[model samples]
Target: MRVPMILALVTVLAGCADSHRWSPQQNGSARITTSDRIFITTPADGEYGDNVYSGSGRNTAKIIYNAASAKSHLVRIGGLAENYQDAINQAQGAEQDILIFPTILHWEDRATEWSMISDKVEIKVEVIQVQTGAVISSGIIKGSSGLATLGGDHPQDLLPQPIAEFVSSLF
Candidate 1:
Protein backbone atom coordinates (compact mmCIF):
# COMPACT_ATOMS: atom_id res chain seq x y z
CA MET A 1 0.00 0.00 0.00
CA ARG A 2 2.83 2.41 0.78
CA VAL A 3 4.53 1.76 -2.55
CA PRO A 4 1.29 2.36 -4.48
CA MET A 5 0.66 5.62 -2.61
CA ILE A 6 4.15 6.93 -3.34
CA LEU A 7 3.82 6.08 -7.03
CA ALA A 8 0.53 7.97 -7.23
CA LEU A 9 2.03 11.03 -5.58
CA VAL A 10 4.95 11.08 -7.99
CA THR A 11 2.66 10.74 -10.97
CA VAL A 12 0.58 13.69 -9.83
CA LEU A 13 3.65 15.86 -9.33
CA ALA A 14 4.96 15.01 -12.77
CA GLY A 15 1.63 15.90 -14.34
CA CYS A 16 1.65 19.31 -12.68
CA ALA A 17 5.07 20.10 -14.07
CA ASP A 18 4.12 19.38 -17.66
CA SER A 19 5.23 21.88 -20.28
CA HIS A 20 2.87 24.51 -21.73
CA ARG A 21 2.20 25.39 -25.35
CA TRP A 22 0.90 28.61 -26.95
CA SER A 23 -0.71 29.35 -30.29
CA PRO A 24 -1.35 32.89 -31.55
CA GLN A 25 -3.74 33.75 -34.38
CA GLN A 26 -3.68 36.73 -36.73
CA ASN A 27 -6.19 38.34 -39.09
CA GLY A 28 -6.22 41.11 -41.69
CA SER A 29 -3.26 43.12 -42.91
CA ALA A 30 -1.89 46.23 -41.21
CA ARG A 31 1.34 47.53 -42.57
CA ILE A 32 3.68 48.69 -39.83
CA THR A 33 6.89 50.51 -40.52
CA THR A 34 9.54 52.07 -38.34
CA SER A 35 8.45 55.55 -39.37
CA ASP A 36 4.70 55.16 -38.68
CA ARG A 37 3.19 57.02 -35.74
CA ILE A 38 1.38 54.66 -33.38
CA PHE A 39 -1.05 55.04 -30.50
CA ILE A 40 -1.91 52.47 -27.85
CA THR A 41 -5.48 52.63 -26.54
CA THR A 42 -6.79 51.12 -23.33
CA PRO A 43 -9.79 48.85 -23.15
CA ALA A 44 -13.16 49.85 -21.70
CA ASP A 45 -14.32 49.24 -18.14
CA GLY A 46 -15.14 45.64 -17.23
CA GLU A 47 -13.29 44.54 -20.30
CA TYR A 48 -10.37 43.48 -18.13
CA GLY A 49 -10.16 43.79 -14.38
CA ASP A 50 -8.30 42.61 -11.32
CA ASN A 51 -9.76 39.17 -10.92
CA VAL A 52 -8.07 36.24 -9.28
CA TYR A 53 -5.86 35.51 -12.26
CA SER A 54 -6.38 38.38 -14.69
CA GLY A 55 -4.79 41.78 -14.24
CA SER A 56 -6.31 45.05 -15.42
CA GLY A 57 -6.54 45.92 -19.09
CA ARG A 58 -4.40 48.95 -18.31
CA ASN A 59 -1.58 46.64 -17.41
CA THR A 60 -1.91 44.80 -20.67
CA ALA A 61 -1.96 48.13 -22.50
CA LYS A 62 1.27 49.17 -20.87
CA ILE A 63 2.91 45.92 -21.90
CA ILE A 64 1.77 46.38 -25.45
CA TYR A 65 2.98 50.00 -25.44
CA ASN A 66 6.39 49.01 -24.21
CA ALA A 67 6.66 46.29 -26.83
CA ALA A 68 5.45 48.54 -29.65
CA SER A 69 7.63 51.47 -28.63
CA ALA A 70 10.72 49.34 -28.79
CA LYS A 71 10.20 48.88 -32.52
CA SER A 72 8.39 51.99 -33.69
CA HIS A 73 9.60 55.58 -33.53
CA LEU A 74 6.49 57.71 -32.86
CA VAL A 75 4.31 56.06 -30.25
CA ARG A 76 1.72 57.52 -27.83
CA ILE A 77 0.21 55.85 -24.80
CA GLY A 78 -3.25 56.85 -23.56
CA GLY A 79 -5.47 56.19 -20.57
CA LEU A 80 -8.55 54.00 -20.39
CA ALA A 81 -11.27 54.82 -22.85
CA GLU A 82 -15.02 54.35 -22.70
CA ASN A 83 -15.10 51.98 -25.66
CA TYR A 84 -13.31 51.07 -28.87
CA GLN A 85 -14.68 54.18 -30.58
CA ASP A 86 -13.47 56.35 -27.78
CA ALA A 87 -10.03 54.85 -28.18
CA ILE A 88 -10.04 55.66 -31.88
CA ASN A 89 -11.07 59.22 -31.13
CA GLN A 90 -8.29 59.60 -28.64
CA ALA A 91 -5.78 58.29 -31.14
CA GLN A 92 -7.06 60.64 -33.81
CA GLY A 93 -6.83 63.56 -31.43
CA ALA A 94 -3.27 62.62 -30.76
CA GLU A 95 -2.66 62.88 -34.49
CA GLN A 96 -1.56 59.28 -34.70
CA ASP A 97 -1.82 57.47 -38.00
CA ILE A 98 -2.40 54.04 -36.46
CA LEU A 99 -3.98 52.69 -33.28
CA ILE A 100 -3.17 49.51 -31.47
CA PHE A 101 -6.09 48.32 -29.33
CA PRO A 102 -5.73 45.35 -26.99
CA THR A 103 -8.50 43.32 -25.37
CA ILE A 104 -8.04 40.59 -22.78
CA LEU A 105 -10.01 37.58 -23.93
CA HIS A 106 -9.24 35.08 -21.22
CA TRP A 107 -7.18 34.62 -18.06
CA GLU A 108 -6.69 31.52 -15.97
CA ASP A 109 -4.76 30.82 -12.79
CA ARG A 110 -5.24 27.30 -11.55
CA ALA A 111 -3.40 24.39 -10.09
CA THR A 112 -2.68 21.75 -12.65
CA GLU A 113 -1.97 19.27 -9.88
CA TRP A 114 -1.79 19.61 -6.11
CA SER A 115 0.19 22.76 -5.27
CA MET A 116 1.59 23.65 -8.67
CA ILE A 117 -0.18 26.58 -10.30
CA SER A 118 0.00 28.09 -13.77
CA ASP A 119 -0.94 31.47 -15.20
CA LYS A 120 -2.39 31.88 -18.67
CA VAL A 121 -3.78 34.81 -20.66
CA GLU A 122 -5.15 35.46 -24.12
CA ILE A 123 -4.88 38.98 -25.56
CA LYS A 124 -6.33 40.04 -28.88
CA VAL A 125 -4.64 42.96 -30.61
CA GLU A 126 -6.28 45.03 -33.33
CA VAL A 127 -4.46 47.52 -35.47
CA ILE A 128 -6.71 50.13 -37.04
CA GLN A 129 -6.42 53.22 -39.16
CA VAL A 130 -7.15 56.40 -37.22
CA GLN A 131 -8.57 58.21 -40.23
CA THR A 132 -11.15 55.63 -41.42
CA GLY A 133 -11.49 53.32 -38.43
CA ALA A 134 -10.70 50.38 -40.67
CA VAL A 135 -9.04 47.37 -39.19
CA ILE A 136 -5.69 47.01 -40.85
CA SER A 137 -4.42 43.99 -38.96
CA SER A 138 -5.25 41.95 -35.89
CA GLY A 139 -3.97 38.95 -33.92
CA ILE A 140 -4.54 36.97 -30.75
CA ILE A 141 -1.61 36.36 -28.40
CA LYS A 142 -1.81 33.41 -26.06
CA GLY A 143 0.79 32.63 -23.43
CA SER A 144 1.34 30.62 -20.24
CA SER A 145 3.99 30.57 -17.57
CA GLY A 146 5.86 27.60 -16.21
CA LEU A 147 4.21 25.73 -13.40
CA ALA A 148 4.72 27.36 -10.02
CA THR A 149 2.81 28.04 -6.82
CA LEU A 150 3.63 31.73 -6.36
CA GLY A 151 -0.01 32.82 -6.80
CA GLY A 152 0.85 35.03 -9.76
CA ASP A 153 3.21 37.31 -7.88
CA HIS A 154 4.74 38.55 -11.15
CA PRO A 155 2.16 38.16 -13.86
CA GLN A 156 3.50 41.23 -15.66
CA ASP A 157 6.75 39.47 -16.39
CA LEU A 158 5.00 36.70 -18.31
CA LEU A 159 3.58 39.08 -20.94
CA PRO A 160 6.56 40.71 -22.62
CA GLN A 161 7.76 37.69 -24.60
CA PRO A 162 4.36 36.89 -26.07
CA ILE A 163 3.70 40.55 -26.88
CA ALA A 164 7.06 40.84 -28.58
CA GLU A 165 6.40 37.69 -30.58
CA PHE A 166 3.07 39.01 -31.81
CA VAL A 167 4.60 42.38 -32.73
CA SER A 168 7.28 40.66 -34.72
CA SER A 169 4.64 38.92 -36.79
CA LEU A 170 3.11 42.28 -37.76
CA PHE A 171 5.77 43.08 -40.33
Candidate 2:
Protein backbone atom coordinates (compact mmCIF):
# COMPACT_ATOMS: atom_id res chain seq x y z
CA MET A 1 0.00 0.00 0.00
CA ARG A 2 2.81 2.47 0.86
CA VAL A 3 4.56 1.66 -2.44
CA PRO A 4 1.39 2.39 -4.39
CA MET A 5 0.95 5.68 -2.55
CA ILE A 6 4.53 6.70 -3.30
CA LEU A 7 4.08 5.90 -6.98
CA ALA A 8 0.95 8.00 -7.15
CA LEU A 9 2.71 10.95 -5.52
CA VAL A 10 5.61 10.73 -7.96
CA THR A 11 3.30 10.56 -10.94
CA VAL A 12 1.35 13.58 -9.79
CA LEU A 13 4.50 15.66 -9.31
CA ALA A 14 6.32 14.55 -12.43
CA GLY A 15 7.32 17.37 -14.78
CA CYS A 16 6.18 20.08 -12.41
CA ALA A 17 9.67 21.58 -12.56
CA ASP A 18 9.37 21.98 -16.32
CA SER A 19 7.23 25.06 -15.89
CA HIS A 20 8.37 28.39 -17.38
CA ARG A 21 11.97 29.28 -16.61
CA TRP A 22 14.48 31.95 -17.71
CA SER A 23 18.19 32.52 -17.24
CA PRO A 24 20.95 35.16 -16.80
CA GLN A 25 18.78 38.14 -15.93
CA GLN A 26 19.35 41.49 -17.65
CA ASN A 27 22.91 42.66 -17.16
CA GLY A 28 25.19 45.62 -17.99
CA SER A 29 24.50 49.32 -17.49
CA ALA A 30 22.93 52.17 -19.55
CA ARG A 31 19.33 52.07 -18.49
CA ILE A 32 16.70 53.64 -20.73
CA THR A 33 16.20 56.95 -19.02
CA THR A 34 13.17 59.11 -19.68
CA SER A 35 15.07 61.42 -22.05
CA ASP A 36 16.78 58.91 -24.31
CA ARG A 37 15.85 58.50 -27.94
CA ILE A 38 14.87 54.85 -28.27
CA PHE A 39 13.64 52.67 -31.11
CA ILE A 40 12.61 49.00 -31.46
CA THR A 41 12.11 46.49 -34.28
CA THR A 42 9.98 43.41 -34.53
CA PRO A 43 11.99 40.24 -34.84
CA ALA A 44 12.24 38.46 -38.17
CA ASP A 45 10.48 35.17 -37.46
CA GLY A 46 10.64 32.21 -35.16
CA GLU A 47 11.56 28.75 -36.37
CA TYR A 48 9.17 25.99 -35.48
CA GLY A 49 11.00 23.10 -37.13
CA ASP A 50 11.29 21.11 -40.38
CA ASN A 51 11.91 24.17 -42.57
CA VAL A 52 8.76 25.70 -41.23
CA TYR A 53 9.45 29.10 -39.72
CA SER A 54 6.45 30.51 -37.93
CA GLY A 55 5.63 34.11 -38.76
CA SER A 56 5.20 34.87 -35.11
CA GLY A 57 7.47 37.90 -35.23
CA ARG A 58 4.88 40.57 -34.72
CA ASN A 59 2.96 38.55 -32.20
CA THR A 60 6.03 37.69 -30.16
CA ALA A 61 7.30 41.24 -30.52
CA LYS A 62 4.09 42.61 -29.12
CA ILE A 63 4.28 40.26 -26.19
CA ILE A 64 7.56 41.79 -25.16
CA TYR A 65 6.47 45.26 -26.24
CA ASN A 66 3.36 45.17 -24.12
CA ALA A 67 5.25 43.71 -21.22
CA ALA A 68 7.86 46.44 -21.28
CA SER A 69 5.29 49.09 -22.06
CA ALA A 70 5.10 50.19 -18.48
CA LYS A 71 7.92 52.44 -19.61
CA SER A 72 6.28 53.17 -22.95
CA HIS A 73 5.97 56.84 -22.17
CA LEU A 74 9.26 57.21 -24.14
CA VAL A 75 9.56 54.58 -26.84
CA ARG A 76 9.14 54.17 -30.60
CA ILE A 77 8.57 50.76 -32.19
CA GLY A 78 9.69 50.42 -35.78
CA GLY A 79 8.34 47.93 -38.25
CA LEU A 80 9.83 44.49 -38.89
CA ALA A 81 13.37 44.38 -40.26
CA GLU A 82 15.14 41.85 -42.45
CA ASN A 83 18.15 41.55 -40.22
CA TYR A 84 20.29 43.21 -37.57
CA GLN A 85 22.10 45.59 -39.91
CA ASP A 86 18.87 46.82 -41.42
CA ALA A 87 17.44 47.43 -37.99
CA ILE A 88 20.55 49.37 -37.01
CA ASN A 89 20.26 51.54 -40.09
CA GLN A 90 16.63 52.19 -39.37
CA ALA A 91 17.38 53.25 -35.84
CA GLN A 92 20.27 55.44 -36.90
CA GLY A 93 18.29 57.02 -39.72
CA ALA A 94 15.60 57.87 -37.24
CA GLU A 95 18.27 59.61 -35.13
CA GLN A 96 17.64 57.45 -32.14
CA ASP A 97 20.06 56.97 -29.25
CA ILE A 98 19.17 53.37 -28.37
CA LEU A 99 17.69 50.49 -30.33
CA ILE A 100 16.00 47.49 -28.85
CA PHE A 101 16.27 44.36 -31.01
CA PRO A 102 14.05 41.48 -30.07
CA THR A 103 14.61 38.25 -32.01
CA ILE A 104 12.45 35.20 -31.61
CA LEU A 105 14.79 32.26 -31.64
CA HIS A 106 12.46 29.35 -31.13
CA TRP A 107 8.71 28.83 -30.82
CA GLU A 108 6.84 25.55 -30.43
CA ASP A 109 3.13 25.26 -29.81
CA ARG A 110 2.09 21.90 -28.42
CA ALA A 111 -1.13 20.58 -26.90
CA THR A 112 0.01 19.91 -23.39
CA GLU A 113 -3.25 18.90 -21.82
CA TRP A 114 -3.83 15.80 -23.91
CA SER A 115 -0.43 15.18 -25.46
CA MET A 116 1.61 16.02 -22.40
CA ILE A 117 4.00 18.01 -24.54
CA SER A 118 4.87 21.48 -23.30
CA ASP A 119 4.90 24.54 -25.53
CA LYS A 120 8.15 26.48 -25.80
CA VAL A 121 9.34 30.02 -26.57
CA GLU A 122 12.71 31.72 -26.56
CA ILE A 123 13.31 35.47 -27.01
CA LYS A 124 16.54 37.40 -27.16
CA VAL A 125 16.73 41.10 -26.33
CA GLU A 126 19.59 43.35 -27.35
CA VAL A 127 19.77 46.97 -26.25
CA ILE A 128 21.99 48.86 -28.63
CA GLN A 129 23.68 52.27 -28.61
CA VAL A 130 23.08 53.68 -32.06
CA GLN A 131 25.88 56.20 -32.02
CA THR A 132 28.50 53.56 -31.35
CA GLY A 133 26.55 50.63 -32.80
CA ALA A 134 27.27 48.66 -29.64
CA VAL A 135 25.02 46.51 -27.53
CA ILE A 136 24.84 48.25 -24.19
CA SER A 137 22.84 45.48 -22.59
CA SER A 138 21.19 42.19 -23.47
CA GLY A 139 19.25 39.18 -22.19
CA ILE A 140 17.49 36.02 -23.30
CA ILE A 141 14.08 35.14 -21.87
CA LYS A 142 12.92 31.57 -22.42
CA GLY A 143 9.74 29.92 -21.20
CA SER A 144 7.96 26.56 -21.40
CA SER A 145 4.67 25.35 -20.04
CA GLY A 146 4.54 22.48 -17.61
CA LEU A 147 3.95 18.94 -18.81
CA ALA A 148 0.84 18.88 -16.65
CA THR A 149 -0.81 21.98 -18.10
CA LEU A 150 -4.57 22.31 -18.00
CA GLY A 151 -6.56 22.51 -21.17
CA GLY A 152 -6.40 25.71 -23.26
CA ASP A 153 -2.97 26.86 -22.05
CA HIS A 154 -0.18 27.95 -24.40
CA PRO A 155 3.50 28.66 -23.86
CA GLN A 156 2.87 32.38 -24.31
CA ASP A 157 0.86 32.35 -21.11
CA LEU A 158 4.13 32.04 -19.20
CA LEU A 159 5.84 35.05 -20.74
CA PRO A 160 4.35 38.13 -19.09
CA GLN A 161 5.69 37.67 -15.58
CA PRO A 162 9.31 37.17 -16.58
CA ILE A 163 8.97 39.77 -19.30
CA ALA A 164 7.54 42.31 -16.90
CA GLU A 165 10.11 41.35 -14.32
CA PHE A 166 12.93 41.83 -16.79
CA VAL A 167 11.54 45.19 -17.89
CA SER A 168 11.29 46.36 -14.33
CA SER A 169 14.96 45.54 -13.92
CA LEU A 170 15.78 48.14 -16.56
CA PHE A 171 14.50 50.99 -14.48
Candidate 3:
Protein backbone atom coordinates (compact mmCIF):
# COMPACT_ATOMS: atom_id res chain seq x y z
CA MET A 1 0.00 0.00 0.00
CA ARG A 2 2.83 2.41 0.79
CA VAL A 3 4.51 1.64 -2.50
CA PRO A 4 1.31 2.18 -4.43
CA MET A 5 0.71 5.48 -2.69
CA ILE A 6 4.22 6.67 -3.47
CA LEU A 7 3.93 5.68 -7.12
CA ALA A 8 0.59 7.44 -7.46
CA LEU A 9 2.05 10.58 -5.91
CA VAL A 10 4.92 10.60 -8.35
CA THR A 11 2.60 10.27 -11.32
CA VAL A 12 0.54 13.23 -10.21
CA LEU A 13 3.41 15.56 -9.33
CA ALA A 14 5.93 14.42 -11.91
CA GLY A 15 3.92 12.92 -14.72
CA CYS A 16 0.28 13.22 -15.70
CA ALA A 17 -0.26 16.36 -13.64
CA ASP A 18 2.32 18.33 -15.56
CA SER A 19 1.30 21.96 -14.98
CA HIS A 20 2.41 23.12 -18.39
CA ARG A 21 1.27 22.70 -21.97
CA TRP A 22 2.80 23.55 -25.35
CA SER A 23 0.61 23.75 -28.41
CA PRO A 24 2.64 24.12 -31.57
CA GLN A 25 0.89 26.22 -34.13
CA GLN A 26 3.72 25.70 -36.56
CA ASN A 27 6.50 23.15 -36.19
CA GLY A 28 9.75 24.40 -37.68
CA SER A 29 12.55 22.17 -38.81
CA ALA A 30 15.43 23.98 -37.21
CA ARG A 31 17.82 21.50 -35.64
CA ILE A 32 20.15 23.65 -33.56
CA THR A 33 23.51 23.30 -31.84
CA THR A 34 25.92 25.24 -29.66
CA SER A 35 27.86 26.17 -32.76
CA ASP A 36 24.76 27.64 -34.37
CA ARG A 37 24.64 31.41 -33.94
CA ILE A 38 21.21 32.01 -32.43
CA PHE A 39 19.68 35.33 -31.42
CA ILE A 40 16.54 36.09 -29.39
CA THR A 41 14.35 39.15 -29.23
CA THR A 42 12.22 40.16 -26.27
CA PRO A 43 8.54 39.81 -26.91
CA ALA A 44 6.24 42.68 -26.29
CA ASP A 45 4.35 42.46 -23.04
CA GLY A 46 1.10 40.61 -23.42
CA GLU A 47 -1.99 42.51 -22.51
CA TYR A 48 -4.15 40.65 -20.01
CA GLY A 49 -6.89 43.12 -19.12
CA ASP A 50 -7.54 46.79 -18.78
CA ASN A 51 -4.60 48.25 -16.81
CA VAL A 52 -3.19 44.75 -16.32
CA TYR A 53 -0.15 43.53 -18.27
CA SER A 54 2.48 40.82 -18.36
CA GLY A 55 5.95 41.84 -17.22
CA SER A 56 8.08 38.79 -17.91
CA GLY A 57 9.32 39.11 -21.51
CA ARG A 58 12.91 39.66 -20.45
CA ASN A 59 12.52 37.10 -17.73
CA THR A 60 11.31 34.62 -20.30
CA ALA A 61 14.28 35.44 -22.54
CA LYS A 62 16.66 34.79 -19.67
CA ILE A 63 14.94 31.55 -18.88
CA ILE A 64 15.19 30.38 -22.48
CA TYR A 65 18.83 31.46 -22.77
CA ASN A 66 19.80 29.66 -19.59
CA ALA A 67 17.82 26.55 -20.37
CA ALA A 68 19.14 26.26 -23.93
CA SER A 69 22.71 26.91 -22.79
CA ALA A 70 22.38 24.11 -20.28
CA LYS A 71 21.86 21.79 -23.25
CA SER A 72 24.99 23.27 -24.88
CA HIS A 73 22.89 25.43 -27.18
CA LEU A 74 23.96 29.07 -27.21
CA VAL A 75 21.39 31.88 -27.60
CA ARG A 76 21.52 35.67 -27.50
CA ILE A 77 18.93 38.22 -26.39
CA GLY A 78 18.51 41.77 -27.63
CA GLY A 79 16.45 44.16 -29.84
CA LEU A 80 13.55 44.10 -27.45
CA ALA A 81 10.23 45.26 -28.79
CA GLU A 82 6.52 45.00 -28.17
CA ASN A 83 5.51 45.03 -31.80
CA TYR A 84 5.92 42.02 -34.02
CA GLN A 85 6.96 43.89 -37.14
CA ASP A 86 9.52 45.89 -35.20
CA ALA A 87 10.98 42.76 -33.70
CA ILE A 88 11.16 41.23 -37.15
CA ASN A 89 12.88 44.28 -38.52
CA GLN A 90 15.46 44.24 -35.78
CA ALA A 91 16.13 40.56 -36.11
CA GLN A 92 16.40 40.73 -39.87
CA GLY A 93 18.82 43.57 -39.54
CA ALA A 94 21.08 41.64 -37.19
CA GLU A 95 23.78 39.21 -38.29
CA GLN A 96 22.76 35.93 -36.75
CA ASP A 97 22.02 32.54 -38.23
CA ILE A 98 18.63 32.28 -36.53
CA LEU A 99 16.27 34.28 -34.37
CA ILE A 100 13.95 33.20 -31.59
CA PHE A 101 11.01 35.48 -31.08
CA PRO A 102 8.46 35.20 -28.31
CA THR A 103 5.16 36.91 -27.63
CA ILE A 104 3.35 36.77 -24.31
CA LEU A 105 -0.39 36.34 -24.55
CA HIS A 106 -1.42 35.75 -20.96
CA TRP A 107 0.35 35.94 -17.64
CA GLU A 108 -1.40 35.83 -14.29
CA ASP A 109 -0.19 35.39 -10.75
CA ARG A 110 -2.72 34.76 -8.02
CA ALA A 111 -2.81 33.55 -4.47
CA THR A 112 -3.47 29.93 -5.16
CA GLU A 113 -3.96 29.09 -1.48
CA TRP A 114 -6.30 31.97 -0.75
CA SER A 115 -8.07 32.58 -4.02
CA MET A 116 -7.88 29.06 -5.37
CA ILE A 117 -6.68 30.56 -8.64
CA SER A 118 -3.51 29.26 -10.22
CA ASP A 119 -0.65 31.30 -11.47
CA LYS A 120 -0.84 31.04 -15.25
CA VAL A 121 1.49 31.91 -18.14
CA GLU A 122 0.92 31.82 -21.87
CA ILE A 123 3.56 32.71 -24.44
CA LYS A 124 4.13 31.98 -28.10
CA VAL A 125 7.68 31.25 -29.32
CA GLU A 126 8.88 31.30 -32.89
CA VAL A 127 12.15 30.38 -34.57
CA ILE A 128 13.13 32.41 -37.59
CA GLN A 129 15.97 32.39 -40.08
CA VAL A 130 17.65 35.76 -40.11
CA GLN A 131 18.19 36.23 -43.84
CA THR A 132 14.84 35.05 -45.10
CA GLY A 133 12.89 35.97 -41.95
CA ALA A 134 11.01 32.73 -42.31
CA VAL A 135 9.40 31.08 -39.34
CA ILE A 136 10.84 27.65 -38.71
CA SER A 137 9.10 26.51 -35.54
CA SER A 138 6.35 28.22 -33.60
CA GLY A 139 4.23 27.24 -30.65
CA ILE A 140 2.12 28.50 -27.81
CA ILE A 141 3.30 27.57 -24.31
CA LYS A 142 0.98 27.60 -21.35
CA GLY A 143 1.94 26.92 -17.73
CA SER A 144 0.03 26.97 -14.49
CA SER A 145 0.49 26.33 -10.79
CA GLY A 146 -1.14 23.23 -9.42
CA LEU A 147 -2.51 22.36 -5.98
CA ALA A 148 1.10 22.33 -4.73
CA THR A 149 1.91 26.02 -4.86
CA LEU A 150 3.06 26.05 -1.22
CA GLY A 151 0.62 28.93 -0.83
CA GLY A 152 1.53 31.21 -3.75
CA ASP A 153 3.55 30.57 -6.87
CA HIS A 154 5.12 32.88 -9.41
CA PRO A 155 4.56 32.26 -13.09
CA GLN A 156 8.26 32.41 -13.86
CA ASP A 157 8.99 29.71 -11.29
CA LEU A 158 7.01 27.21 -13.35
CA LEU A 159 8.66 27.98 -16.69
CA PRO A 160 11.95 26.09 -16.60
CA GLN A 161 10.56 22.64 -17.30
CA PRO A 162 8.36 23.68 -20.16
CA ILE A 163 11.06 25.92 -21.58
CA ALA A 164 13.53 23.09 -21.37
CA GLU A 165 11.19 20.81 -23.22
CA PHE A 166 10.63 23.43 -25.88
CA VAL A 167 14.35 23.94 -26.31
CA SER A 168 14.97 20.24 -26.58
CA SER A 169 12.32 19.91 -29.24
CA LEU A 170 14.41 22.21 -31.42
CA PHE A 171 17.21 19.66 -31.55
**Per-residue alpha-carbon lDDT of model 2 for 78-115, expressed as tens digits?**
88988889999999989988788888777788878888
lDDT of each: 0.69, 0.75, 0.76
What TM-score fits each model? 0.71, 0.80, 0.81
In candidate 3, stretches whose alpha carbon ends up further than 4 angstroms from where it belongs are: 1-18, 50-54, 72-74
**Sorted on TM-score, highest at the top, how do the candidates line up?**
3, 2, 1
- Tell me, by lDDT, which candidate is best: 3
Q: Distance from true position, residue 45, model 1, in Å?
A: 6.9
Q: Poorest 10 consecutive residues of model 3 by lDDT?
A: 46-55
Residue by residue across 1-171, what tens digits does model 1's lDDT show?
999999988875654442323354445655778888889887642232455433456788888888888888688778776678888888988898888988767665555334455666676778887887777777666655555333433444567877777776665
RMSD (Cα, Å) for all candidates, in order, is 4.8, 3.0, 3.7
Cα deviation of 109, candidate 2, in Å? 0.4
